[model samples]
Target chain A: MMRVEEKLFQNRYRVDGARAHIEIVDGDVCAVHCQDKPCTFCCPAGCYAMDNGGRVTVITDGCLECGTCRVICGEHRNVRWEYPRGGYGILFKFG
Target chain B: MSEHFDAIVVGAGPAGNSAAYTLAKAGLKVLQIERGEYSGSKNVQGAILYSDALEKIMPDFRDDAPLERHVVEQRMWILDDESYIGGTYRSANFSKPPYNRYTIIRSQFDRWFSKKVRDAGALVVCETTVLDLHMDGRRVVGVRTDRDNGSVYADVVILADGVNSLLARKAGFHGELKPKDVALAVKEIHFLPEQTIEERFSVKGTEGVVIEMAGRITQGMVGTGFLYTNKESVTIGIGCLLSDFKKSGIAPYALLEQMKAHPAIRPLLDGGEMKEYTAHLIPEGGYNAIPAIYGDGWLMVGDAGMFVNAVHREGSNLAMTTGRIAAETIIDLKARGKPMTARHLAAYRKALDGTFVMKDMKKYRDVPAVMDKNRQFFTDYPHLVSQAARTILTVDGVDKKTKERAIRKEFARTRSTLGLFADAFKLWRAFE
Candidate 1:
């Protein structure tokens, strides 16, 4: 099976290197409220993760802009989600 | 400083393009803005284009539209772990000219559609996100974009921005989308030689086949998987409710990988090079989940209004139809010298109610809820059905009557007779 990252690598993106479109509004919310951190698993782009230090991190570079993390994080409402500014995110070549 | 137009359209997907095209063609001053680099760059679909909708907008679309294939066959599969038992509907009539549906790649199709909108005199600006609606009290006066001096005024704003319509929510048009309201779909386009695809799918020329699968493929989730044959590529994907994925803790890509490895699906994609991987949200909430579609000086179309008929797996058609209807409502109101108020724009909703967009949505309103509660249809039932097929087809040397009894027993084991009846009744009520 291809890793989620391998699959995401097939997509095109004009990454907004200096900024992230999706932000964890409260990282502590994931730690205290969500034991599983659903976004860490449910995100199609594999953008959410737990670091070695047990901190939640969201790398928005490969976000397919599917809005999964935002909607899945409904209980905590932790994701400050927005579409990437203009043409700065994943660009689907064959969408 | 601000620029104003007769109408401003947000998001250049099917819905936005349809609204922009219709309004511009009717001689309205229209400005359509897209956050993608181009019209379809951010868009994706299983992509069965309903010609009737486009025909209503541009009757000559067949002339140069970048259509991949006309669907002449449709296969519905009920899959188990390693086998599928389903039916195929193929017709010579569908193979004839003036097709009813055609497979499309959104990137190519949307670019062509935006071109038509531009040719109709609509100003289509890409790479510009509408940050928010410029509201004066409850009335939307214009939109604030990411660009400098990006506040653009309009008599009316149409929000065609796909499912994640943050602008609509920011403008307080709707609350945050419930997980049950939208589906997270992941798709990959596999490239194959044209002749190879033709021989494999039993299609020639522009003919195509669409395979819709349900059952274990989604890991018992209330979702489906599909494969559509394009000219030289096969579009394969799977999606489940966001709530389902959350509950199952199944990564979307993993579900897709399992589906591709299914015996029934593996051969179809053999030797195909996957070139694109995409994931997007599809509003599957049906009728009950539809939000405020129209308000003072603004209207919502497409997935923003939750127009997807998940029952039929038909979204682009509804999106285009709603967009066109919304545009027509605006055009009619403009012609009558009426303001684009909530009262006047009620015509858009009323117009949609008269079309299949609302009718189909209303008809299948109960389906999603029913399916959500009924797990057997996605899990045990598929297994039972496939087992029955295998039992009946395999030469076990058992008598026909005994085999029939065994099949009944298998079904009864999965769902009791009363449970079976109730499930059937539930499905009947949902579909009815």
Candidate 2:
């Protein structure tokens, strides 16, 4: 019945300032969010969520950084991907 | 001037963490470089962590590691369209202290292990991609990263990167991983209340079950499906050889959807909210697919060295074990003030051979090949067996002898006696 304690802080490497931001510009909508967005079903982290108007929004914070969205999102070129600044992404407890 | 350390490890997953932890704990200066923003950021698993290997590294890990459930039961099912024929093993002993295996979420586990590495005094850097190896005439003396001013020298470099290790390939340590040597796996984690998971799996708090399956699920491809009960969620996945998937023209997610809809599987996941879905590549090439493990001033561990034992669904454990062994080898060499040469580092290979990592891999080296070549095992045989079991078990007033004879006919109809015998022989050879 012993439980494993989760790690509190993880060390990461990332750009220092505004340059480290992952930007999604308005005109950069690479693919129109469809009624049945495949990313909603395929993304493991549920990072891609659809709104009432069916506009797909991506929250990169919860991203596991598995690259599934990047590879499977062939319909869109909007995912300007890069690793989060060193020490700031998903940290696995048991992986 | 080049900065030198006792060791530099690339990719801070299970392998890199293990090596770094071991070397640093032994008073050696170890630097671990990870491409992900942080360790475990890019990792995924239907993860069952074997305690034996991890215990070797962190003996009192159970006191600190974030484990979901200790697996007391394991079920292997052979599924047809609607029915399945499978066996289960459950033991109270498995639930006792020092449990054999535990289910884990990779994201949490890798973070914990990495923390242990840092606490052990290894300098760990993340979000740094190693562009290539820095060689001094066949001696790998350092790594050149993508970061500005990123070139760092070391006495040795251990490549613990996972399956898609471009560094090792670019360094000419191995060729491209053929589709046949890898499997594309897709998995989803369905979140349910803890009580629901226990009720569905017939276990109380902290007890867990793992179900492994093969059959019509893969659409006749050489592959398998799995469902593991975590504390409050279920990990369901299906994976097929990349080559088989490519040739069959089936998307990995489609296969996972089909598996979720399976009659025997659907009920367990009923009412569960689907939370996370992810896919990853598993290196299944076994012993033969292992590339050069050690070179001048360099070593390879984990998936980068093709250390997975696919037959047992074990990769992380192998990765950790190989990492530990590699670190041990380096520590021993350094203690003797020996140079990090390929000849000296061959101890890593010898240590691996003496461990279950090499032994288990060697034992099942032929399984993937055999299973790939024999489509019937994944398709026809499961259907026939499930049908026969259904027919025999259903009481339709048919004579018992008739039912028995019908089962025999089903088996014989699908495979000739010679074919059946060959399957048994192949299985034996694969496992022997």
Overall lDDT per candidate, in order of appearance: 0.92, 0.79
- Give the alpha carbon lDDT tens digit for every residue of A1-95 in model 1: 87887887788889998788888887778777777788988999888889875679999988888888888887888889888899889888989
As for candidate 1, its clashing pairs are none
| Residue-level lDDT tens digits of model 1 in B161-263 | 9898999888878999999988989999999999999999888999999999999999979999999999999999999999999889898989999999999
Q: In candidate 1, residue B5 scores what lDDT? A: 96
- Model 2 chain B: weakest 10-residue lDDT segment is B245-254
lDDT of 2 by residue, B112-161 (tens): 88999999999988777677889899899899886788889999999987
Per-residue error for A61 in candidate 2, Å, reads 14
What are the per-candidate TM-scores when only chain A is compared? 0.92, 0.62
Once fitted onto the true fold, the runs of candidate 2 whose alpha carbons sit more than 4 angstroms away are A1-95
Maximum-DockQ candidate: 1
Q: lDDT score, residue B243, model 2?
A: 69
Q: Which one is best on TM-score?
A: 1
Per-prediction DockQ comes to 0.88, 0.15
